[model samples]
Target: MLSMAWLASALIGAFSLAVHAEQSHPAGKVHLGASERRADVTGLRPIITWPGSRPAQLGQAPSASTTAAPAPPNFNLNELMRSILFPNANVIFNVQIVDPGEKPKGPPPDIAANFSISGWGDNLYPRWDVVSYGAVGLEESAYLLMKPDRLCQNGKPVPVKREDWIKYVAELSATAKAVYTASLARDRDAVAGLADRLNESCATCHQAYRTG
Candidate 1:
């Protein structure tokens, strides 16, 4: 019904309108259909945009750098036991006989004058915080015991791979965790009661491993 020239002109006008509509919008904006625009405007759905590729998607494998933890440092088993375990165990044991909440007697020592002493002005014993530290040290000692390439005093490798050794370490860690929990509650009797269990855990390990 229409002439060829009129039909061509109508087509050109439609193309120009489409081009203008596209140009009017800001760059990087997705052109939505009428229904999508209505949904977006009504807040039914939000549009999300990222500057680059989307961050690690769910179920994606992690990068190689984040795959494994660094190796533990090599340390002597005997020194670790003496320095970290023995001293901390003593702190736990002391709690059985002494009340951690009790304040130190007399005036605090002059720190400047007695700086040479290891604990100078600080309370040397019976502190709830120290008890917690000791317990934590004992618990963490289990990990140190299992350290790769650890050696005992007599030049033999630590029996970390042995089943009995693993069991003893687990017992020590559990008792130590219990001691720490009691220490946090400031329950002196509770901590005191755990001393025997802690001692037994240590004694069992020592009997099995420390004997020459």
Candidate 2:
């Protein structure tokens, strides 16, 4: 009878140890059945876990508190110049070279008919609105140029951190604002007069950073 009692106690202790082992198992070390092991091996098992070991709801959006904020956009310096600064600067520069009030000699082009493309002579030139937009674009370009993560054409990061680059961008912004004010007043002479200062601002920056 004593031997039988001893055997019963030993079996109870082993059973308790087994249960404790399962409960105390570290995360991701849970024992799996053959089918579970097969599913894991085949990558058919879901791996995501929720707080307090709760199962995730199907098709449910994650809580905003848990979601990461989106990253800021990055831009290329060359593309920014070609698309924004160069085109807008041309609008200001054209006011100096071409008479904005001059009428087109020929009939309106196909671009005017179907709006297939944007042109300078009839669509952009002589229009105070377009020139104003151009100046606004130039002012905005100053901020864009200073944005972090912008890359140059050579795959190197833009030197926005440099003091000279900051000064150049500030000059561009101030020049753009002056052009915008002149454009608003419809003062062709004022816009024309500021063209030299605008050119000088751009040329100085290019000579320092862009040219070989």
Candidate 3:
């Protein structure tokens, strides 16, 4: 009887451990277990510098210029701006999640979500709101600083026009704000979409704005 009791206890302990492992492995925003890391928004290490270096301020929204609005250019600033720009949010809230499904016994990683990463960020990033709102994933709101016309360090006019650039900045910043607001509302799809929009804008702008 004692042997049987020991066997049963062993099984229970093993089962408990297995359950714990599974809970840890599957769920929102896990950083430690995955073979490769994926960003909540962009799936890559986000650039987190621009402020301290005091990146040059580009021109702002143009006062109504006399130039007439021609048909939209064949190239897409919406696409580029949405891709190239990246905000320096992590500088403020550099969060990470080690596991998702499991309720951590003692403190867990910096952040975790039950359903998806956006939700995780909703809770985590907001905690840092008073500190910095940059990583808040304002749609297409991010841009690589000092990348004039995308020539960046090349010192040349970006193929894009000044007006388009300014317009995109407004669009991205506004979009990110709107999206993050939606996330705070617990709207998952919109929140995730905004993250994508932010990443896409940063990449696209970098390409067109960068010197070839």
Decoy 2 TM-score against native: 0.60
- The most accurate candidate by TM-score is 1
Alpha-carbon shift of residue 34 in model 3 (angstroms): 42
Count of backbone clashes for each model? 0, 0, 27
Worst 10 residues of 1 by lDDT: 117-126
Clashing pairs in 2: none
Q: Please identify model 3 stretches exceeding 4 Å from their true place.
A: 1-132, 135-151, 156-161
lDDT of each: 0.77, 0.77, 0.44
**Prediction 3 TM-score vs. true:** 0.34
Model 3 Cα lDDT, one tens digit per residue, 125-151:
223231224434433234432133444
Q: By lDDT, is 2 or 3 better?
A: 2
Q: All predictions: root-mean-square deviation over Cα?
A: 26.0, 28.6, 19.1
lDDT (Cα, 0-100) at 23 in candidate 2? 65
Error of 1 at 209 (Å): 1.3
Compose the digit string of candidate 1's lDDT tens values, residues 1-212: 77768856875686676567647853223356478866666733444445885555444576898699766556678889888998889999998788888987899778556543346213433367678878878988888888877788887888888899989988998899898888878889999889988888888877877776
Top-down lDDT ranking: 2, 1, 3
